[model samples]
Target: MPCWYYDKKELRETPSILDGISFETERRYRKEGARFIMECGTKMGLGHNTMATGVVYFHRFYMFHSFRSFPRYVTACCCLFFAGKVEETPKKCRDIIKTARGILNDNYFYSFGEDPKEEVMTLERILLQTIKFDLQVEHPYTFLLKYAKCFKGDQQKLQKMVQMAWNFVNDSLSTVVCLQWEPEIIAVALIHLASKLSKFTVQDWEGRQPQHQRWWDMFVSDVTMEILEDICHQVLDLYQSTQKETHQSSSPPQKPPSRAESPTAVKSTNSTVIMLSSVQQQQPPPVSGNGNLQEVNNIQSIKSLAGGVPVLSSGDAPSLPQGPTPPGQSHGYHLYHAPPPPPPPVVPNVPYPTSAWGVQQTLPPPPMPPSLPPGPSGFYSTGGRQQQQRY
Candidate 1:
């Protein structure tokens, strides 16, 4: 299926303002405090937009229902699961429980201790039904990647912009304003901040570079600037506070999500953050050595890459063919036992390559000075790097 990266008004119904639970009551429930919600939102891997929507769901659910009447954390899990389904990559139930407990333990470790895993699982079912299983919400990650690639200046400058945009995304999750804007608007704002930061970073280090303005016009919009400043200010506050506590501390035990005094049967949040914490902090005894360590390390690496534990890449790393090669470097080409299916031939007039992978990119022509003829204009423009097409 084609991946979508933005959502519009019609696709996502704007939730009406919640009134049942006054903002003050919600604030008070969190006053001991509100920051954990942001921390949990981040851990949920819902991203800024997903978290914003999830918070909206959480508030709307509670507006009519009282927090005192039923388990509120179950509602939190429901919001995240609902958002996750809406956002395409739904997290596993066990993983969600793991992370939420870890964060709660950091501050209120002693007070809250009850398993909410069952509740989270049950909530997941309800959430799926409510949204009718329509996952696939838009995210800012893709746009930032596209924007970064469009920059023609020093490669590092472009990369810095990408990184800045990512930070902007993380910061957006922490503030109330996330609830007010669409992700695309937020994305545009982030790219704008990224561009300014890129310019600033470039000027401070290497002075100005070339062709910076070529891609500048693509990002110019009134909405971009307005949201960019608002996002930047919120992100700046986050940086000032330096909220690394959630990530810094090792994952805690998978505690049930409930107050000890509460009579309700507990359910763990099963958050991925908690899973990492359990692995990192509550280290189980060594299973074995060498081979086992490599396997464990591989799992950890994939979890880190996926930003969640369960979606790990499985199967052993391929065993190397016996050949003369240096110790550290991989063989330049991999050989398979069977011949693979041939890809569709490239259409003669199209701008991109037609391979099984589809639309591969080749390096751009070498940079030409404004004054000089760069090179031969008749070079065969294949538009993609040539690979050894073995029969």
Candidate 2:
């Protein structure tokens, strides 16, 4: 097998498309590819070791190949194809191609020709060359089981912790941590994480010790607390990032405005109005008292009334001022007509000696003279003719 390494400075510069992709995107791609590999392996009734080895093969190949040049799904199928043969549980090339096509569908398979078998065969050659035919991969699962046996505890509880650690090992393959750390280091870290989750403490079994002595000291003398802690943090971070992505993708999409409510359309309308206003202000006042002058004043009043509310263009100014047209002319000139004359000033409701037309037709009766005495008879002193006439 050949040795592979990357320069930290060069990776930070992100020289290629593969390096340019975000860590989250790469992790998701790797995870999805691994899932497909497992699905294909399951369909062929391969054992767990075979499926795991296939996923390892997939990861090892991508360290050299860019996702842009060769897609993950195709490479995934090739990994399983090669893994199947190496693990001594060989599957036919046609059967593997057929199963992959069925699971992934035709759209996902990249092919040079119409036949998917040809593509798989080509991918296998490239995969073999990429890894330099290194088929022996040490998985963390074996080490995890070995370390679990050292813990002296209830068989049931220990079994549960071991199972949890096994799951962590499987999930860790999605991360690049596996490539960076040894299998034994990852196995110990996973067991530590699982122990915390399961509330199973090693101190209870091993008893307290001085600062120099620790639990990992018993099984692997070289492993330190710092190394185990780093691995655990990496695994935990992966889970946290995955959860966040799931929440974001599951959220409802925001609704955009309809055409009528669009801000761009509204802004365009306001701009048009402002332009028209500016043009009107620049022109000299239309000849005073002319029909066009009154129309211009009405347009200004309409602008004030609109209060930035966009309306019809300047051509529609004639329809804005509301009133009946003057008798001979087709339109009225009064842009600001005073209200009607205020209804004849509201007189008191008392009667007056006036005729129907509101003009005085008769005078009021004159007052009688105070000097005249009250008399039932005609004036006696006036003449003797009164002797025979009644008084």
Candidate 3:
């Protein structure tokens, strides 16, 4: 068989990079494609070996072809479809396409064109050529199991270590580590990593040879501490990289802690009013008529994220700045709208700004109060009523 192994230098610059795709983008695509294959296969009731075979095929195919040239999602589907046949658990092309359609959104499914079946079948031939018809694949799973059997220690710890190693094998598939080392070496490295993490040191084992100084030496004489650690780092980095994304998605960014009050402090400090999310998401910070800096932490802006948002301050309220003239000077919009509308028994024929679907829609005929003098309670009055303003 042709040598499939490559060094880190070569993988760092893949064919996708040469085709104008950034290294980061290409790396992201590889992970997403492998994940797609795994998810699609799981839904199809395919075995782990079948999915692993598909993922390997995916990585190998991209090695020769550019991700810019072919869509990753389509190639992933083709690989899964072909691996099913090679692994003797074939699924129908239509069934696979249906599964993908449900998993992928319209943007990804658009690559399948009018007839997805034809798209996958046509790519199947190119995939075969790229992999050079190397249908026989041997994964680290078998080697991991074979080497693990020799480990003599707590059976439960051994089982847990084996399980972690197996997961490492699965995760390692998403990386180019498979293309850089043989399956036996990867198995040894991962098993060693798992043993160290589980704190189950294998001091004694079966088939102990006098020449071997370490447990791993019995299997691979060329293996060293550096090589094993390198493999371990490569696998561990996958978790750390994804952890950042998970953290970002989990927190859901609380609107960048609304911009602080402008540095300009005139005699009559103009306190800014802010319109936050619907009451269902977050409540506005309690602001008294007295000068108290409203808390800024818990607020999500309803505006576009292009610029800084106005903050809440308790002082003399200022009229809102007029909006830009609407395109073509459309009469449908109001150029100047005051801050939050006050109670009735005041001014009429006023249009307030509201949102329908992100557009600044106009609410017609809402009675709004004109600028009133400050009340004894230090609050602004609207029609003789001191209404507490909601941020």
Which stretches in model 3 have alpha-carbon errors above 4 Å? 250-391
Better of 1 and 2 by lDDT: 2
- In candidate 1 the C-alpha lDDT for residue 20 amounts to 41
Predicted structure 1: lDDT: 0.42
Candidate 3 residue-wise lDDT at 118: 90
Write candidate 1's Cα lDDT for 282-347 as tens digits: 221121111122233222222221121111111212233465543223332222222323793342
User: Each prediction's TM-score against the native?
Assistant: 0.42, 0.58, 0.64
Per-candidate RMSD vs. true structure? 27.1, 41.3, 21.4
The reply for model 2, stretches above 4 Å from the true place, is 4-20, 110-113, 204-212, 252-391
Instruction: Kindly list the per-residue Cα lDDT of model 3 for residues 12-90, writing each as its tens digit.
Output: 7788887777776677677768867877897899988999899989989988899767888899999999999999999
The window of 10 residues in a row where model 2 has the poorest summed lDDT is: 264-273
Residue 237 displacement in candidate 2 (angstroms): 2.7
Each model's lDDT comes to: 0.42, 0.56, 0.67
Clash list (residue pairs), candidate 2: 378-391
